[model samples]
Target chain A: MIRSIFIKETQLLLKDKGTYFWLFVLPILFIVMFSSIFGNAGTTTYTIRYFDADGTKESRQFMDTLAQIKGFELAADNEKSLADQIQAVRDGKQTSLLVIPQGYSQRLLGKGAAEVELHRDAAEDAAAAPVAAVLDSVTKQYQEHKLRVALKGTGQSQTGIDALLTAPIQVKDIKENVAKANPVTQIVPGYTVMFVFFIMITMIHNFLRDRDSGMVSRLKGTPLKAHQYLIGMWLPNMMVVLVQSTVLLTFGFIVYGLHLGDLFAVAAVIISLSICATGIGLMLSVLVNSVNTGVAIVQIIAMGGAIVGGLWFPYELLPKAVQWIGLFTPQYWAQRGMQDVMIRGAHLDGVWMTILILLAFGLAGLAVATASFNRFAAKAKN
Target chain B: MKHVLEVADVVKRYGSKTALDQVDVHVKEGSCFGLLGPNGAGKSTLMKLMTGILQADSGMIRAFGMDTRHQMSEIRQRVGYVPQEITLYEKLSAVQNLKFFGEMYGVNGAELKQRIAHVLEQVGLSDRANEAVETYSGGMKRRINLAAALLHQPQLIILDEPTVGIDPQSRNHIFEMIRGLKKEGLTLVYSTHYMEEVEALCDDIAIIDHGSVIAQGSLHEILEQHADQAVYVESDYITEPPQLSSIKRASARGRGWVLESEQPLHTLRDLSQLFAEAGARVHALELVKPSLDRVFLKLTGTALRD
Candidate 1:
């Protein structure tokens, strides 16, 4: 009986083109669009155009220092006129333009202040701000070097000058327990979990349609038990969700190069999430009175859960209250579990808690849904 | 004859509304028992209870000599039900629907396949067995619905208004199918508001109203007990109502007089004599036996469909 019902339900689902689109096409579209927009996270490099009118050693040394800074690729195109560089900046092709004055090195050596001109596009302020800050710090270091050289000339010892120039305390930055947070990891699993809920809408629709059409009463009239009928109703939906998740995850891996650590752990998370989603579908199927009401409720659940549970973006970026509320959604836990595996390279040991929580959600949903289904069957029969 | 189903003082209620009130019924084995009632007359409720889909509020229902509550699985295996509405997977083919329902009743493998083939042939939809039910016509769908019920080959078949919303030819085909089942000695409990269907197919009947069985007996017995014996006479001279002493009630019916009496033979003889004395020849004088519709009207004081 279970096999028969499952096959029938699966055939029905395959026949529904709308469900096919939502299950497969929508998730891939979300992944591809978001990946293209936010693909270059840590790999992005900003170009800085520099021109040196002063060919002195000091200016040459400053240019060398600027070239070694992280995430800034220096372009000292002396052949191109400074006017052309400025035009590039104005046209938004260049992020910023730097120019050294004619007497810069001589002024610095002779204890006279010198100024350098930096031109940037206002619209590129976000990218130009960091370049400007780096330039300021490099200039300050050069001034400090000049001061040290002046002090040495005044007969101060090298050690004393070095100690004075360096601060009494040294600070170092150490990153702790941080994973590689990138757009691919975030959006792939984010949309995967988000689209998993869409399967609930299909499940609820099939359930309500069968009930309203009197098929439920007919099935109950047979010798099949209630649990058998429940399994028959639930298993096919669960399988559809599992297939949807697997396909989306595979698409993410192939297209976006999504890194999944411990495939078994990821599979466990997806299985639990599918069960939870199927449970929600079951509960909603009986709770609502009509197909229109069921569709409305499912929409609220899928779209609302996606927004609140950080499927589109990280919940940590939201307000503390919203983040706390996100903890209440199954999507939050499922997305968190996927992030652990894909971003943190977590193993099975790491995601067991998330699996258990999702399982609890699924079990609770099944309990309430089963009770409601039984009540519905009884009422229908009467 | 052995009793296939028995209901004694069964009462079923839905909140404040009583759907079945002190309903008692007995279905003899190998006989077609027609449950006659108007809409909401407890026919469906009683059918559900007998099929073990529903439980009575305060009474016992036994089918196949077993309690419905305790032996539901056994009873379900022995009874087939065709609901008033189409209960099928519209997207699935007739054969697929039959196969699935057959599996639910523990029929599978070669047996299930053979049953599906047999039922599709029985319903005369063998050519359209692979077509989706949604693509089939209403009569074809109804045939598939009946085929689904017969998949398990249950001893008793309970149909709730099975022939509703179908063409006359299809209705007659359903009657032929029911007759075929009856020839096989399958006990049938058919409920419908169509009196002609009951009159054509049923051997025994129960007429219910307001959740109570107002009349029940063999077809002939119920007709004899409640139906009026009237002699309809048509004569050229009888333009107005006839005044006959032997007739208890005489009323003019279009170009004729319908005369009711305790002695129908004597009333007919007196009508013929009166027509001869009036210098008018009687063109037609025939005894009109009461139909089930008239019997239902006499018992329920309303039309069968009302």
Candidate 2:
């Protein structure tokens, strides 16, 4: 019976021209739309380096150390000039770069002064000057060590001066799992969840289109039981949803070097999420009996889900209360789980909570849908 | 199978209105039984209950020896229902609609294709099988509607006014199809307001009125019950309705006026004397037997067309 329902649903869906336009074609159009609007945040930045001419040992140390920063797309350019590199950043051809110069180290040993010139891209923050100051501090510490070496040659006490140059208590920097991969990996899972949510909720406009078409009354007469009939609707819709997820995820894997955790685990989550969304569409189909009503309901839910789930904006930036409310939406859980597994490289055990919560959401929706269908059937009856 | 369908004392209600009140109907095997009634007569309601689309509030409905309430699914698998309205996806073609319904009844592959081809040809829509239903004519749509029901080879097929409004060609086609189905020994519960259709097609009929079957029997029996129900009138009558006691109830149809009377013999004898005294030329006076339409009027207090 279920098999027959599936075949019938497939045939009906194929026959419906609206399904093609609303489900498959429209999602691709929106992907292009959203990729352009939120491109600034979702994209990782490229790194541009400057070969500054201060030539000091301290300057060289800082130039070599810039690779440690996160989200840096390290690239080599043959422009080989500070002015050219800064122009690149200004032109949006590249992001910010640090410049080091050929400098005379003799000034530090001969006199009590040394000057190192650091030129930043004009587009960068005015805060770069203080960052230059921090670099100067490192140079000053080197000069003092040399001075103490010279004093030891003359038999003077260097302990007090050493304490002045370097603090007695040192600050330790701990490196954990955050800065290990490209920053695009950080946003990929979030984008997947957000896009899926947007596409699913927005695509429910198709359900509204069905009402005026008289397709609902037609299917009701078929031997397809309503529940199994609903599941039949899920198949074609999930085809489009799964394809969208696959396209975006595969792009992430190639371009951003994003990890998908386990192939099986990611696939499992994607498939389950597709099922959940299809069920959501089915439920929406029941409540919104008219095409206009369906469109209105879907638009309202899509925008609301994106807002609450922090798809357009990050939840971390929001206040505590709003973030707590965000947790209630299914998009939030799926997004969180995707982040946990893909961005953070967490295992399946890490997202058990999210999975369970999504399952509950699906079950609850199914129940509501079943009840709504009973009402719909009774109402349509002559 | 003792009988295809049997309903014993079925009563259905909607809120304060009684749709079916103590309606008992049984359809025997290989019988083309028609339940004839007009709008708001609970004919559709009774058909729905018998087909397991709705439940009888206070009675039992059995189809093919099994109870309807308990075996609705099993009965639905074997019973085909074509609703009054065309309940098919308009975007799909005739063949696609047939295939979808055929597959729903567990028909697939070569067998499914064969059945679809067979039914489309049976309905004389084989040439238009690939055209979308929205593109078909009203009569063409009605034909495909019947074809969809015939997909599973149902033991009992119920059509609610299969050709309600169609061209004469489609009407003849449907009449022939019914005759063919009857010959093939399929039990059909056909419903319609056209009493002539029942006369031409139905092997047996249950004349329904107001929420109950007022009369049920063969065509000859119903006509015989109201046989002494004709007015022999000859006159230069007015084109308008004649209001007189000699013609107790008179109406114009087909170049003549048919006036029905409770006392046909006395009314005809008085009509001859009254028309002769009035110096009228007696054109043609014949005592006509009552038809199903007259019987419907006599029993229900209204004409079939009204």
Candidate 3:
């Protein structure tokens, strides 16, 4: 009986175009969109608009030095005066501007201070900070050149000047587990986990349709039992969630080259996550009174859970309070479990806690659904 | 005749309102038993109770010599119920829908496949079995709905308003299917408000009103027992109702007047002689045949639709 109902439901869902759009197409679109936007974040360039009041070779050389940096570009916009460019920054039209005063080249030749002014909007501090850092680094390099010339004048050897020019502290950066930690890692698994819960919407629709159409009452007259019907309806949705997850993750793998570490552990998380989602789906199917109400509840669970559970972004970037609350959702556990295997290179032993928590949620949902199923069946049209 | 179903003093209530009150009905084997009533007359409520979809507040229902409360599963295996609503997955094809229902009734394997083919042919939709139900016409959908209940071949089939809102062709097709089932010695409980349906298909019937069985017997018995005897008269000269000694009451009926009496033949004879003496132009003057419509009107004091 379970196999019969499972096959029937699978066939019905295959014919329903709406389920396909929700469970598969919508999530893949999100993955593709977000991955495209954030994939090249490390190499994105920021423009620093500047006016060189002194047209001498020294001022042009200063501009050339700043432009050589990888992510910062110098744009000479002479159409707006220095004052007007400053006003543009104040009006929030531009993030920042740079000015080289008239005596900059003379001051450098005369052994005096050469200063360049950087005017930026306070509200656009995040965008302006990087430009400010680059200017400061260029100033330090010029000071080093002056020091080298002064040391040579004092009769020191070139080797001593070079040793003195090195900074006292050296910051060496090391990257770990960065083989695949790109936007693809966040987007592919995030969207797959987020949209797997949408199976609840389809479950609610099928259950309520069965009740309202008198199918429940009609089936009650048959030899099929209540538990058989409940489990029969539930197994098909779980399988659908499994298929949806596989399609999305595979799309990420093929299109974005998302590295999947430990295939067995990833598959385990996928299986457990499917159980957790469809189990809650069963609970909601029996608890909700109408299809509209069921849809509302599912939206709250899927969308709200996605936001707090870090399915839209990395969990480390969320507010501390939200991160604490995220631990309570099944989505958080499922996503953490998948990332632990895919991003952290964790094996089954490392992710056993996640799997257990997810299964606990699924089993609890099944228990509630089993207890309330009689009331749900009783309300069917007879 | 052996009784296949027996319902004694079945009373069902929905909250404070009573839906069925002391309803008793018995169905003989191989006979078509019709439950006749207007809408909200408790015909569906009683049918649900018999199929074990609902439990009566206080009643004893036995099907195939098994008690409904304790042996409902056993009864469900032998009884087929076709609800008033067209309960089908419209997104699925007719063959798919039949396969699901056939398995639900515990028919499986090659037997289920054969039965699916048989029922599709029986409902006259064998050619369109692969088409989705949503694509079918209303009459075609109704045929498939009835066909779903016949896959398991239950001994007793209960149908609640199965022919409502159907085209003439589909209704005739269903009637023919029911007749064929009866010819094969299957008992059927058909519920409807149409009197002609009962007259044509049912051997025994129970007329229900306001949750009670006002009358129940063979089709001939109910009409003879409660239907009034009357003579209809139409004449140009006798405009007013004729004042006769034998007539009890008189009322207008179409272009004529129906005069109620204890002896309809005597009143017919009196009207004939009066028409002959006065030499009036009598158009229609005859003894009115007893009908369930008149029987329902006499018992409930309202039309079936009302």
User: Against the true chain A, what TM-score does chain A of candidate 1 give?
Assistant: 0.81
Clashing pairs in 1: none
Model 1 regions lying over 4 Å from their true place: A44-128, A141-180, B234-239, B250-257, B277-284
Q: Note the clash tally of each candidate.
A: 0, 11, 0
The fraction of reference A/B contacts recovered in model 2 reads: 0.34
Better of 1 and 3 by TM-score: 3
lDDT of 2: 0.70
- Which prediction has more favorable lDDT, 1 or 3? 3
lDDT of candidate 2 over A236-320, digit per residue (tens): 6677678868877787677556677777667767777776666676677667656567667666666677677776566677678
For residues A1-382, write the lDDT of model 3, one tens digit per residue.
Answer: 8888999999989999999999998998999899899988857998989999998999999999999988887788877778888899999999998999999999988979999999999999999999999999999989899898899999999889888888899998988877868878888999999999999999999999999899999988898888999999999999999899989999999999988889889888999999999999999999999999999999999988898999987899999999998999988998899889888899999899999999998889999999999999999987
The residue-level lDDT of candidate 1 at A78 comes to 67
True contacts kept of each: 0.91, 0.34, 0.91
lDDT of 3 by residue, B64-112 (tens): 9999999999999889899999999998999999999999988989999
What tens digits encode model 2's per-residue C-alpha lDDT throughout B142-249?
888888888888889888888888999888888898899889998999999998899889877888888899888777776776544775444575355445575667
What's each prediction's TM-score?
Answer: 0.87, 0.75, 0.97
Every model's DockQ: 0.69, 0.25, 0.85
Better of 1 and 3 by DockQ: 3
Error at A16, model 3, angstroms: 0.8
